[model samples]
Target chain A: MNRFASAITAFALAILAMGAAPVAAQQATPAVTLEGLVKLEKTIEENGKQKVVLEEPKVVVPGDKLLFTTRYRNAGTQPVDNFVVTNPVPDAVRVADESALREQVSVDGGKSWGRLADLTVKGEDGNPRPATATDITHIRWTVPVIAPGASGMVEYHAIVR
Target chain B: MKNARTPLVLGALAATAIGSTQASAAGVTAGTLIQNTASASYGSGSATTTVSSNTVTIRVDELLDVAVSALDAGSVTLADTAVLSYRVTNSGNGNEAFAINVSPTVSGNGFDAAVQTIAIDTNDNGIYEPGIDTVITNGGSTAELAPDAAARIFVIVALPGGTADASASQVRVTAQALTGSGTPGTSFAGQGQGGGDAVVGATTANANALGALLASSASVTLTKSFAILDPFGGAKPVPGATVTFTIQAAASGSGTVSDLRVTDVIPAGTTYVANSLTLEGAALSDAADSDAGTASASGIDVAIGALPGGNSRTVTFKTTIN
Candidate 1:
């Protein structure tokens, strides 16, 4: 191959790689993940800090408090901003007052989220009642910035109804 | 408000307060798998969809509920007709059929009724009107009862005519979910969806009635006494001995009992002595063609007419113990 033809081939390869930027961006993650757990005073020391002993239990009865954790990692070489993660509470269980962090809850299955006081659940009498700790249906968190290669987790507690 | 969640719910907490429970077939129940996919969008790029690595499914499940409307035992009488009404409700979350079987209470004292029949209260008026209501075909599966709905059952029991006075007998009626009648810890399959529901009722709903003796003020009392006479004219209970059974109907109440008749079925181990029936000290022929009485190998029947209040009439028949 002549120099001119080799130059054209290299340029075509570069264009093709550029066209596949979105697919590669998706595969090579600045990614987020979510987890669910049931905990009650199950504290464990992790890295010199006491936190809930995360468990994957086989059975859970009424009144059990659950902790949901969402971990986000920036694997790609780029700083990400406006990070947000939302989780819908299990329909049969309710959210507790003290969550792992300050978060918003949704009573309408993640359609909209707000403080617990701003939510409502239709009760047995078919009347709208202020959302109690057990009425929360979804939990959400917002992060202003997540640097490259950095990972963090957000969590909340919900009591089984 | 409606939840477009499009899942059937039979959860007791969310529905009825009774022990009945709810089940959903959206592939989620306690102690069942709950898979949630999570994705994120950031850095002005399309969202990255990743199934949860921090994922878990906390145990949850559905419960089966079967209940009777009545909360108390009922009352009936000896030799009288009684009706037991039970409103069997399916408090569960989906539609299902229930099987019904009735019997004298396993641990009760009431003598079993001679004639007991079960009928569905088709009119929902709680009446067991014959010809109007359809029988459950000797206590069988009910026609498709729906969730949150109830079907009324009428158990008509006729106390055996020969029931002893001042006795109590009870009858029990049981209803079982045909789908979940056996084995605990097995899934109760949701009516519409696949697989099993989380929980099921171990036992079905059963209602019982205590047919206690009301101490009938107008009732007549009968006493039976037997005496054996041997070939040697000595009292004996041995086989081939002549046995005399005296049945005395004494009126103690202040009301006359009309249309009174006396019947004696020969004992299994005894052979009837011909022409040996005495009613009120009058001889009654042991012949089916005889006047005012009929006789057969089974026994003898005599028309005793009426016994006034405070009067006593005695009927005696002789048989040979075989």
Candidate 2:
């Protein structure tokens, strides 16, 4: 009878101890946690002249090429995806060149757009020729994604007629 | 055992509470955040936005004022006794309130003030004396005026009723604002005055002095005439031809001729040879010629350079037509 009682007490004590041990252990060791962060930074630089070139500055009247370059920096801590930037050409100027990233051509003063390949022009033979991407005067870059702290540059050329 | 469990539970709760607070302060949660999100451990921050603009410019316009008039003298025989009538008006912007007065200063042998009665004839009698006045019946007087205002006044004089006419006379008209102010406003007073005069004509001496001053028959014939003679004559050459025209302009009348100019019409079927003309031997290239091709040649300007009582000159021109 004595042995039975002792055995039963021991079993009960072991169960309690097991429960208590788990709780104590949990308190002793710190909980594991995850922290995530997302940050964005931007830098923009204008490339036009400080003072407007009045009368076109008499630059070699026959032909003139003006290059305007704009730089956009993704100075943030996270990646930027599908970034879109737009620039308006002044009334006195016409765009002559576009970046390789151009995807569409806007005919109605850039209010709407169409694919370069889909655009057509009557050839000397009166047949349509597929407009090359180079024929596009405006550009839209779908970076797909820009890694954090990355930068990009877009440049276009203007010819004074 | 119970005490130990209590402490462990409290510690876990405390850590969870602290973490939750930090997350709340960072304004983020496990759920979706409609705007931007940041981690609590990374701390808090802010962002700024900026914009740009352009410059512009502007412009404005201006105003002006001017006028002219005419006067005439009737049958006053004495050189100093000739009076005339004039109507003046303000043909400009704003009001014009002022007084105007006139006087005469004569030199040479033709001045005779005593025989001249410069009176404001208020009555209409064809004569300047008390009973023969005309201006009085015309309702004209000397008074102040506002913009576009008008006034008329008369001058009277005494003369040898017969043919002893007065030669020339110098007349001046001085005007002043009744309110003692100048043009444009009531701040300053307008200085000086403006007016004109006429050259003297040859006078017939008094019957008593005629015999002594006359060597010839004393028969003086005065005539005033103007002509456009072609110095290089021959069929009134083409309108713009470089032709010289002699002006036999003379004031043979008893009085002198002042402010004289001879204007000629290029005739029908003719066009102004632009900028190819001269007057009084001087090239008149700067004169405006707006009537070049018009049927009416209104821009024929020939300044006679002051034709004395008896003087004239020849001018030439050359031009091309459209």
Best by lDDT: 1
Worst 10 residues of 1 chain A by lDDT: A1-10
* DockQ for every prediction shown: 0.12, 0.01
Q: Best candidate, DockQ-wise? A: 1
Which digits, one per residue and each the tens of the lDDT, describe model 1 over residues B86-152?
Answer: 6777654345567877766546664666436788888887777998887886558777665557788
Tell me the chain A TM-score of model 1.
0.63
TM-score: model 2 vs. ground truth: 0.21
RMSD of each: 14.3, 36.3
Q: What is the interface RMSD of each candidate, in Å?
A: 17.3, 33.9
**Model 2 ranges with Cα > 4 A deviation:** A1-161, B1-70, B73-82, B106-109, B112-141, B159-166, B181-186, B189-322
